[model samples]
Target: MKHVIALDVGGTGMKAALVGAEGELLYEARRETGRERGPEAVVEGILAFAAELRGYGIEHYGEPASAAGVAIPGVVDAEKGVAVFAANLGWENVPLRDLLTERLGGLPVALGHDVRTGGYAEGRLGAGRDADRFLFLALGTGIAGAIGIDGVIEPGAHGGAGEIGHVVVRPGGVPCGCGQRGCLERLASASAVTAAWSAATGDPRATAADCSRAVDAGDPRALAVWEEAVEALADGLLTAITLLDPRTLIIGGGLAEAGDTLFVPLRAAVASRITFQQLPSIVPATLKDTAGCLGAALLAWDLLDTEVRA
Candidate 1:
């Protein structure tokens, strides 16, 4: 009846799951992060949520969780278990792993970057499972990447390795939130597509989904916007391929939901641009939204194994 606690904390919400030893999910829950209430409240909410999961495990399974893993957005120093900074949650240098351990009666906890953790799940159990080296990119509100090598995601020297979003794809074209002009996120992310569609269609509420519909309907304007985003994305990805040489590229997030509308042209665009680098098989992510939670569970399980070995 032993289990691990897995939590994926986002800007506005948190998803948690109790996972059995063999990776089966025993229970799942979701809660608001209450980020608007401030950083302290968000921390408190996370602690309380973990505690509730622990209680639930003991009540339902007759055993408390032995370990925990937490995935948080923004800059995270996984080795030190510190959440370096998360603008959405107003966090800075928060020692989240130790706090969660203390709240959970000294249970070991593994902390990770949200995107990296999700990519870990995808690499181990989803799109990149067959590849020794792969890159996972999520094109959501913003674009981010995780580099997976031999089943492990590399966090880099400063825990900021796969930040492909900030890479300038359009020189001096558009302003980015990171104080840079023409970032990849500004050009290729779902939010970017939605913004373009909204402006083009004169619909203030137009979303990326609407843009996809328009593209499907053969709307020339929507096609133009979609192709523009795809081209920018291909440019950014080419830079990554030249540097990393991943065997596979896994694409996920809200925009990827468009399926062939995004992938068909993207593969061709990337193919046309490659000069010397080997072409990577670009595939859609299979795990979807459950990746982060499942990956947190994987981290918890890894920690547990390490502890037992020690």
Candidate 2:
């Protein structure tokens, strides 16, 4: 059975799979990224993980993986197959693609920004499947987005596009690690909600999921926190909608797991704020946490197809 190795590299962990030509996941696995050790350690972890997957394919599938793909956090020079910078991983201008290819014995490898790769998968196989234009928002530990146009996720000129989370929705409100004050991400991300809920309950262990539960129980404090997040997210989304005019908006990541708790209010809030902007069809991503891994597989398949065509 022919297969390709696919890996999704996150700040703390990695999801990997061996995908058959028909896009079925022949095998799946997960492991820590080992980022706590250091940036170099993280790179080593990724290389080791990919090599292991290659070996697995060779053993179980009767042949070595023909190609590999990885989706990673932070700035990526996809065209050059380099991970430019990842603040969380403390890396700068890492030639990650070459390292992975070399580790996998020169297998063709494709590298992409994590959010963009996931969004592309959503556009192709999930919520935004038929949409001509859409924006995929990931409300995770930090917020990020990818603009999908005609089934392709646009990587922008500098690989920094679809940064809807960075829009200053509340100037001078809260400082963000991005060195920006009151960016939407600081107020609307899952981590932001966790922080707000923790501070409100005076419990360091309180999380965004707790906040969502509290909201379900009609707790005023949780309501306040959730409301703030929704408002800020709406403002930020409006900015994107005005600029992109996407026909659909696919919401994903941890926050989206809130389901109606996040989507109901989010839709209402966005609708309440729109003046002339089109109210995009807001929908939750169907892929959940597995989107990145599936997307990585898609990237690997795309690489193979491109090579065959060339």
* Alpha carbon lDDT of each predicted model: 0.96, 0.92
Runs in model 1 lying further than 4 Å from the true structure? none
State in Å the error of residue 220, model 1: 1.2
Q: Could you tell me which residue pairs clash in candidate 1?
A: none
For each candidate, give its TM-score against the true structure: 0.98, 0.98
RMSD of each: 0.9, 1.0
Candidate 2 structure quality by residue, lDDT tens digits, 92-183: 99999889888888899999899989998899888999999999999998999999999888888899998888899999989988898999
- Point out the worst 10-residue segment of candidate 1 by lDDT: 19-28
In terms of lDDT, model 2 sits at 0.92
TM-score (C-alpha) between model 1 and the true structure: 0.98
lDDT per residue, candidate 1, 1-310, as tens digits? 9999999999989999999887788999999999989999999999999999999999999989989999999999888899999999999999999999999999999999999999999999899999999999999989999999999999898899899999999999899999999999998899999999999999999999999999999999999999999999999999999999999999999999999999999999999999999999999999999999999999999998888899
